[model samples]
Every structure is written in structure tokens, then in C-alpha cells.
Target: MFDYSKLITGDMPGDKIQIGDSHIKRSDTVFPILLKKVKASGKTKIVISVYGGSGVGKSEIGSLLATRFRSNGYGAYVLSGDNYPYRIPAENDRERENRFRYGGLSAIAESDGFCSDWMDIVHDAWLSGADADPELAEKYEFMRDYQEAGKTALSAFLCTPEEIDFGLVNRIIKKFKHGEKQISLKRMGRAPEELYFESVDFSSTKILIIEWTHGNNSALEGVDFPVFLYSTPEQTLEHRISRARDKGVDSPFTSIVLEIEQQKLNEQAQTASITIGKDGELIV
Candidate 1:
């Protein structure tokens, strides 16, 4: 049997691991051997993405993998995709309504229908080039050096209790889309854009990882290589309740978790029916 713990902890050969009908493999064979070759050749940096659901330990595995790559003396840069930006729950009705109105509009901007509008900003920044932002460019260089050493850069946009405020998400989305002004975070100074540009420069080999929670799996629509952590909905509820207990949060949320788990199981069964017959496999 495949070890779920090993997969979560990311313990396996660089080649691949097979479990049931699913297989987990490295992004590419070149990934494992790139350190010596890239250092000797002095080539441009490479970028990779590691994506998975939350509680499945995406971030933890990403860190360990990045560390291993660095230990091989290869320039490895690991940046978590969670650092982008998002909104938090509103406290009151007024705050919640304001967020809903603004959030609806922002969500439109983030949609595929508004790709041109968003891409315009990207193009303008690219045309203006690095000279327009020498400071950012230099910061990138610093990041490249650190990344070349195999350091994992941890960042996230998930709403934690402390950071939960709809206003913050609006600001982040606005700054991200319009580029009108820069915003700073508590621990990390400067806006996310500034930090992102800086990190890119220091990394010759980049691995981007994201662990998603608090939303639907469809949230990762455009991701290249996506991985889903599969388990029964019963197991999911058990996991959530166990986690909540571990955190000292004794709430009525267990019932809510149970409800969600039931709904998820129904949906999963429906999907399975569509993909495979009662006996499994598709009809010829």
C-alpha cells in the first residue's frame, strides 16, 4: 500500500511513486541533476510550481524539497504562491456589504473576461522595463543570490484570524491590478509586487508551491500541473474536527464540518459515476 504519510511528508525517490491508480513524480528528470549543470554552465534560472490542497502539507514538503536541492549546491528558489493577496471575512454587516460590493467588482476584474484589462498592466510594466525600477531590480539580484543557495521563501495570502479584514484584501487586489500605489505588510516591508520582483532576480532556479484551503478546488483553474489529495469525505470531517481540537478551538463547527463532508461525499460519488461505471472503467 502507498503511504499517505510519506506523500504528505514528501519522502520518496526523485523518480516517482505509484499509489493505486495515481502516481506522483518529479516535474522533470532535469530537476534532480540541475544544480551542478546550472552552476557549471551559468545559465538563466528555471521556475517550477508545486500545488496541492491544504492540510496535505504542501508547504512543509516544499520547504524540505527546496532544502535538499540547495544542499546539493544547486541554486534553488522556492516561493509559495499563497503570498499573492486575498480578502478576509467582514466583522459587521456594513463592512460585509461594502466588501461584497467591492469584491464582486474585483472578482470581475480577476475573471477571464477581463484578461485584456489585467494584461495591459503586465505589458506596460514589461515595456517600461527594469530601469524604471532599479531598486526593485537590485532587490531581485539579492534574492537571486539567496535562492542560488537553496532557501525557501515562505509567503501566504490566506486569511488568518489576526489578519482577517475585508479591507486588506481590497487593498491588495487594487494594488495588484492597478499598480496605483504600494502597500506594506507587517513583517515584510514594501508591497507584494516589489517583493515579487526582488525575489525573481535572486533566483536562478525557482519552484513555486501553493496549498489551497477555504475555497473550491476550481480556484486553481489555470495552474499547469495540479494535484488533488484524495480521501473520503468521512475522513475529511474527522481530520477537520481533529485539527480544530488540536488548536484548542471547541466550537459548534464540528457539525458544520460534518455537513460539508456529507455534501462533498455526495458530489464525489456523482463525479465518480460520470467518470466511471458502477463496476469502474469507462464503457467502450
Candidate 2:
């Protein structure tokens, strides 16, 4: 049995709003439930994903879950989704720009069944001088902006499952499942200039925990248990602002990005085995 008491903490104002001390409340509430589910699944190797939008307390809850599993005599490892990015910060900016421009165009062309030659013409028009025809110019501008907006909307989240180094994540998970004793990972940092290597000893590890906003993905096919935490945009914004204040930084853009991320993340909730609502209530 898991020690539920360790996950509890003192009451705080944020708990009422489901942000600060709520991680402890939710984790404690969910620990035994998750443990029972894992045991019932009958899987020798267990993988759990705690996923939610920004400021939804994924890392904190994931850590608490790992502790619970460890105390129960299970070897557990916690992996951060932040440590897996398609590119470093500097390179990612350029990549996003390119993906937004070219990727959107390609998607448009494919969706419309436009031949390469026709796409080339449209592409040229977009790059060439302004059109003399007002209607044509308006159409071109609308298409350009539409594509840019679509990509911008998705990129705002910074790292989606598509952007993660799933190849490495899968490899690590596979090694653990195969009973590998230790593994080294090239972990990513919050900034482009920062990156470091770390090794994990998984010799006795029976459960692997991965948490991220985009943790719900096909790449992680064999997750024994998946937990999805949900929070409204208003609550998320409040939590994000509070966190930013604590960090001594101001980020107005975070609100805009999180608004989009919240919608995307909600759609992913269906993929989870367990879901928790904004009030820290479990949703069956």
C-alpha cells in the first residue's frame, strides 16, 4: 500500500483555487487509486503519464506519484517532458518559423489536392511583388495570414508531443522494460544555451513516470496508466501569473499561448485512463 500521508501539505490560498497546495491534495487523493489500477493491469512494467496544460502542476504531481510508488517497494523513475525537444531554443525559433511557413503551405496544398505545379504558382505569387488585382491580393493575404496563424497557434506551446525526441524517450522506456540497470540521457534545459547529460539507474525500477503537457501521444504506446489533469484557462492564467511573479519575471505572452494550449490539451484528455478536473476532483 502507498503512504498517502506523505503527499499531503499545509493548506494554502492556492488550494482553494486549485493551483498551489492542490498538487498535494490531488496526488494524495489519486495515489492509492493509481496503485490499485497498476496492480490490476497485470503488467510487469508500468509507465504512467501525468499530463496537463501549463501551470497545471504536472511536475509536482509526477514527483509525488514517483515517491508513492518507491515507498511501496517499486523502483520508479520520473522523466520530464521538458527535457525532450526537437531542437534547442535558438534552433527551435528558426525551425518554428520555417515549419509555420512551409509546413502550412504544404498542408494547404495537400488538403486542397493542388498539384505541385499549381502550388509552385501560388507560392511564387506569395513571394513576388504585390498584386495589382485587389481581390486576388486580398485572397493571397488571407491565405498567408491563415497559414501563419494556424502554425503560430500550435507553436505557442513550445513543445508538443510531435516536437519531443520520442526516439530517445522510447529507447529509454524500452531499456527499462528490458531490465537495463542504468541509462544516460541528454536532457534539455529551459533555454537554448543550456543542456546537460544525466544518467538514471533503473536496475530496480518497476514503474516509469513521464509528465508533460503533450504526454498524451501515440509514441508512448505502452503506458500502463495515464493521468490527465484539467484546468480552465482562467485558473491556468491565474496560476501562471502567480508562478511568474514568484520567479521575478513577467510574461504577458504566456496567457495567449496557454489559451491555445488549453484547448489542445483538453482534446487530449480522452486518451487518458484517469482525468482530474480543475477543482482537483477526479472525473470518472
Best by lDDT: 2
Clash pairs (backbone) in predicted model 1: 45-204, 82-157, 143-202, 144-202, 144-203
**Candidate 2: 10-residue stretch with minimal lDDT:** 8-17
Candidate with maximal TM-score: 2
- Residue 1 accuracy (lDDT) in model 2: 42
Error of 2 at 131 (Å): 23
Q: In angstroms, how far off is 207's CA in candidate 2?
A: 1.2
**TM-score of model 1 (CA atoms):** 0.33
Q: C-alpha displacement of 16 in model 1, angstroms?
A: 28
Model 1 misplaced stretches (Cα beyond 4 Å): 1-53, 72-74, 81-85, 88-201, 214-222, 234-284
lDDT of 2 by residue, 201-274 (tens): 77777888887777776665556677988888887777667666233112323343565667777777777888
Q: How does each model score on lDDT?
A: 0.32, 0.66
Candidate 1 residue 56 Cα shift, in angstroms, is 2.4
All-Cα superposition RMSD per candidate: 20.9, 8.2
